[model samples]
Target chain A: MELYHRIQIQDVVRLDHAALDAVEAGFRALGQGRVVQPPILSMAIEESNGEVDVKTAHIRGHDRFAIKVSPGFFDNPSLGLPSLNGLMIVFSAKTGLVEAVLFDEGYLTDIRTALAGAIAAKHLSRHDSRRATVIGAGVQAELQIAALKLVRDIDTVDVWARDTDRANAYAERIRERFEGLTVNVHGDMASACREADVIITTTPSKSPLLDAGHLPAGVHVTAMGSDSPEKRELEVSVMTCADVFVADTRAQSESNGELKAWAGKTMPFEVQELGPVIASGQSPRTGHDQITVCDLTGTGVQDTAIASFALKRLVA
Target chain B: MELYHRIQIQDVVRLDHAALDAVEAGFRALGQGRVVQPPILSMAIEESNGEVDVKTAHIRGHDRFAIKVSPGFFDNPSLGLPSLNGLMIVFSAKTGLVEAVLFDEGYLTDIRTALAGAIAAKHLSRHDSRRATVIGAGVQAELQIAALKLVRDIDTVDVWARDTDRANAYAERIRERFEGLTVNVHGDMASACREADVIITTTPSKSPLLDAGHLPAGVHVTAMGSDSPEKRELEVSVMTCADVFVADTRAQSESNGELKAWAGKTMPFEVQELGPVIASGQSPRTGHDQITVCDLTGTGVQDTAIASFALKRLVA
Candidate 1:
């Protein structure tokens, strides 16, 4: 089997129009019930304070699919190594032969995840939106803004992080990359999101950081972190108050994202998945003053979609 | 990072004592409650008449773990390709970094599976055994006999299959391989198993093939092929009649093995996993006339164990 390194993959996969469309198509297939996705196969290695997740999906009729293996060793940063590293194995959906081994090392995941946030904003946020308030100053915090630009004319970013230095550093780097774009570092999350058209939570915070009072009117919020049972970025009131509550997948949202606060209780209102909502082509955001929230804990279909897209570009 | 092809893996891994012991140690860890194994993540591609299974386990304190991806495209044989092909990814338990990739293409799984049957017989079968009966003239039917030789003094074989020519062919091959061993191709299932000291059912039959009447006194029956919901090889009476009933893992067995026969209902006897039996250093087969049965549904720890062992030999 052919093995492609991170450099090769980085050259091919991007948080651009084609990649976003590919991922959106995956959600469309998933919404149409043409995708075969199993529950995430997760293993915890307590001795190392690490976790690994194996995810796969087969979009019916698609010629190719992908299985993603992602590992996160939290202690790696302490050892001067990156905390997350992994790869994707793309395969022929018809014959099960491997198409390629993409040692992208989680690059595709980062792109796909950021794109998912953009997807939610595209369908739920106001069309004339121009500013994004990003929580956390990580790689995702930067990529989320870049991806949001594909769907909306985003030219400004408000950054908030627990670490002021990291937030300021993020502002400097993003401003350099996105020329002439406005960048502001906020000391408080409420102020960061006070006048934003869209809000994105990209922190690994284990407590609720964003709530109804912090959300601006007509703002579309994408909580892209909080993918574990212990992590929660949005308070229950935020979900309860949103005019449109979207989950990437309800099962995953309930298990890992903002919806965990209402895990067993009956939902106060109808909750729709981002897939079916996008597939319907009818925006749930019918009014400009609506609060839209999407809990994107991530899904296997995104991995499969991004990997398939990566292979197409690499082979081309 | 290092990808080892089938030949490279074959050169290092074998169905021998060390390999068997490694696999056994995995089960020992499992039985000792020192292993973290999740349920198999399975996906089916109906368009291709194919299925894929992803399995992995973390043996606490072990330096490494393995995630195995196995694919079976049943229609491949119709296209003149082998029906099974896949690989294993071995990672560092400490840092979650890629150590090696075993592109064994299901070779390691075959060895680990066959060795699991041998492990069962070694712990549950009578020690003073010489003759054997293996139903189904498939790859496993042949490997079971070769693996059985590691723990028993097998000198005679009784084979039964739906295909007469294939059964006769298997008889010819094992005769040449075992060198002067008596080989008998039986016309019926009952007679094939009547006088055997060890009776192994290795077919993908959706219905039961072995029953109480077919089991000889002191015979140890290892049903190794029923690893799916619709597959069964032994009748309920056979399990009830056996002095001890064993499963590789009760959860897997309940979902995809002989234990599926009693999936919802409680079994008539105490069912133990082969691992605990080995770890305890006590055979449930106390009497020579005792009929012991083991359901070998396979496990993630076996894959982790075998792949870790394979890497050790390759790096050496």
Candidate 2:
């Protein structure tokens, strides 16, 4: 007899530090060349203003893997529906029988994405970092900061948005969530990153938002908003000025992330991957005066990792 | 405010002639260049002899599309489990919201594949064809013969299998299904095609089973088994002898079907697609003695079409 399990969003919302660690381990395995991840299968539904992407990865010696179907329809919001929704289908790697279906409705994607941001901060940001800057006032802005709290002692936050009212509202929510932390709303991106130990960009802008002049010495920048070819968060000059630059996956970074501006051009510095840094137990940012940048375009390894983690927790 | 409907195998078993017609229309659309189908995403799990394939297609101007995940574990039968299992997820094209999930196992695949064979026979075979020859006594052998009855007046079946006992048993089942129809078990493939109007091969042999010498004049052959690079059901000589050669898709046929034998080699004929032939309302087989061959490698449009058809019936 065959058995199937369906895990809903409520079950997945309870993820914690353990889930973050699981995703980090997936990155480590990928850096060690122990995972098989294929190029994403993307299809455009032009009439509906929608796109669907199928992603999967197999970790060597792992008992299970996941195939995630993620679809985004830009017109969904007008119909009173969320723009992003889909599920992850998990199968036993040994027998290929479906072990479970995570009907997360994009919750797991949010969790894994935020956790990836935290993973980058943990390996590149200063250990005693207490001030952080967020470049967007959306759902991801809050989640990315919350995830960073797991790895650092962040006690102050600087928020910046294209609209002042949205930024102020975002600051109020942050103050309510973190009692003793100070939340300051900034009018410009330059002011928000001037004095912060870690800066994160979470906007879906088609043009570059942050440049080299916006960065401060000894700061770590995590660009999490650009995950498509049309999106860019950091300028090419910013990447070139940084002492060290890392990517979640070099191929994805060059195609869809902040590094896209420098895609076919050669650079003076060697590009490092986040997975190898975590696996090797070394921080690329060795001094307090060195600038470091990490570009995350997401990977299938993270989906398989997070799905496996959620299944274990829900089943238990 | 999200709703999900699950249609099980029991619900899909009620499919009738309308479902077959819906799939035929999908082929017609594909032939007219009104469908956008991405290449299939396939992954192999070597340890368990398992492979997973993700197929999807968007029909122009349709309200919804489908993404089907099909997994095959060859070793499952040893553990008393079915060798194939998976589901189809359908999303609304207007809003990209998942409208339904069809947990029909592999029933939808079986339905679409069998209907594709019927569609090929409908457009390529002689209008008065009455006798059919099936080269393998598998589930598809029974389904193909049954589906062909929708377009032709098939009253007699010649069953051939590697094992004579299985062929005899298959003949018995066909006799019970269609009263007053003559069914014969043949020991060799040549004898089965000696006096038949339509021939269908449904086996997983890693070799050539039928050659030009096995085919008689005016016979239409539908090879539905060789869906992988290592599998072949017909020899190159048979294709060279046919007056018209049709493929479900030229790319897939060249890689995983009987056409693989002619890959990288120049052929005397241009390969036609089944969809265009049906849409043009013209049969390439001009004379009663012309030999026609169709290699059915399957396509994502069939999955989307059949899933949409099943959802309409189940909801009504």
Which fraction of the native contacts appears in each prediction? 0.88, 0.54
Give the poorly placed runs of model 1, Cα more than 4 Å off. Answer: none
DockQ of all models, two decimals each: 0.91, 0.62
Top candidate by lDDT: 1
A16-73: candidate 1 lDDT, tens digit per residue: 8999999999999999898999999998998899999998999999998899999999
Residues A1-316 of candidate 2 have per-residue lDDT tens digits of 1222334545555436888889999999998988888877878898888889898988888999999999989888888988888888888887777777777777888889999999999999989899999999997899999999999999999999998999999999999998998999998888898899999999989999999998888899999999888899998888889989999998888888877787678766789999899999899888998999999988999999998888876677
Interface RMSD of 1: 0.6
Highest DockQ model number: 1
In candidate 1, the residue pairs with backbone N, CA or C atoms under 3 Å apart (3 or more residues apart, or in different chains) clash, namely none
**lDDT of each structure?**
0.92, 0.87
What lDDT does model 1 reach? 0.92
lDDT of candidate 1 over B249-268, digit per residue (tens): 99898999988787679988
Clashes of each: 0, 0
Which pairs of residues have clashing backbones in candidate 2?
A: none
